[model samples]
Target chain A: MSIWEYANPKKFMQTSGLLLPWVTGLAAIALVVGLIWGFFFTPADYRQGATVKIIFLHVPAALMAINGWLMMLVASLIWLIRRHHVSALSAKAAAPIGMTMTLIALVTGAIWGQPMWGTWWAWDPRLTSFMILFLFYLGYIALWHAIEDPDTAADLTSVLCMVGSVFAILSRYAVLFWNQGLHQGASLSMDKTQHISNVFWFPLIVCMGGFVLLFVALLLLRTRTEIRARRLQALLLRERMA
Target chain B: MLPELGKYAATVLGAYALAILLIVGLVVLSLRQATRMRDRLRDVEERVKE
Candidate 1:
């Protein structure tokens, strides 16, 4: 019933199995609808033309890139405080996915930029900090794989996550920290300035939600796999000892 | 979609294609890795049972 109860492997596996199907189904639907709406239904920007459509994917992916790091930071904190094996494993599992999303966002952003800003690369605050965030993700992931001892890996990874969280927040707010160059205002906001019209916003929200769900499903799958792998290693050691 | 920008379209499409391909490849690799580990776990459990 409580979060701690699901810390047990058996309970976690069962719950993940039950939830995976629904998550997959919803993600598929949301992606399809979002792509269709973004590509066709949304009116092209008066200034940017059809290329602006890339914003639908790029924005959501960028948002997730920062948020993924935050989630890892939280998981790492929980693992360090409670020494929950699942928490550490989940943090490890999430690293690759977060890195992938960050790459997508960076590439898509550059592509979008060439047509609008006439330059593929910019030394602006937002861009520089985002690149740093990506580097931090790579470092975190590398640290996990390089460590042979699981306990040491978890401990070091927790410290790295905490350190990375500072950079992640700075990367997210980099635009506000310094006057930005080509990057426009937030596409979707709480105040509804409506940089993007309704037709696109609806589908973009769906895609963003779908992407978050996909991240969750992948993280769960990877964490479960890691747990099983560890269990197998333990058994092998026990057999050898006997 | 850009009529005069046909060359740029190729670049854009290429980037998107590569990203999607990478994602598909990563998914396949992860799924295979998960299943293989699961099978190994089962085997160890069964051996212990014996």
Candidate 2:
């Protein structure tokens, strides 16, 4: 079937049903492999010791946290302009996953920081902006629950998603913008003039790719659930009217 | 049990355990939620058919 065919809710659900197990299996495998490879095989940083190993989890989750929000922002914009119900639901579905990733990043970050930076928390721009991004996630999830009208909720939340994206962008680049930071400079940046060793960089790329797939699997499952919920709600409302 | 865990290793192990626990919790909760929604929708649909 063409990619567009899955745009229909029933078709989407069918596709998800087939895809879910494979995605789930892949996620479990990749996560296990990545963690094992990171902890045991990868050499410890000479300076940071075993503690720098947190990068395997911290970096990937942090990257996903930002990218997930960007996905929601784009989906929200599409939904608003095109009035696509699926697009709105996709945005809503992504919120919790994004929020979880953000929290993962924050906690792992603190753990990494305590040993290295000699503190559990700091008001550095990178950390501060991430905290704000977490708040935006909370606000988005709360808005979804608070509004009784789905259409209204979608519209308002989409607008908020657009407005709030600035902070998500800031969270990514805050280190570069300012001179002061305990945080190491970006290991990966748009300007690829500086290159990292293949040993570290290669696995990092694999983990990142694994994370992206994991996110896709999660978002698709969540979106399917959301569509089912709206369908049930519609059915109940119709029954009441009858 | 590793020897060094008495001091700094405790924090490191604790942090990893906490992260793994939280991730497991999140995945379980998400799966439960998705299942509930799907089942509820199916139930409602069956009722309408009746």
lDDT of each: 0.80, 0.83
TM-score of 2: 0.92
Runs of candidate 1 exceeding 4 Å displacement = B1-8
Report how far residue A41 has shifted in candidate 1, in Å. Answer: 2.9
For DockQ, the strongest prediction is: 2
Per-residue lDDT value at A134 in model 1: 94
Candidate 1, residues B1-50: lDDT per residue as tens digits? 53332335554565556556656675677788889999999999999989
Give TM-scores for every candidate, taking all chains together and pairing residue i with residue i.
Answer: 0.93, 0.92
lDDT of 1 by residue, A1-242 (tens): 58897777788889888997788678778777776666657665577766766766787778888999999999899888888888888899898888888888889888878877898889877777788889999999999989999999999999999998988898787776577555665677777775567767788888788778778878887888988988998999999999
Best by lDDT: 2
Candidate 2: tens digits of C-alpha lDDT, residues A136-207:
999999999999999999999999999889989999999988768677778775555665556666677767
TM-score of chain A of each: 0.96, 0.94
C-alpha DockQ for predicted model 1: 0.41
TM-score of chain B of each: 0.81, 0.80
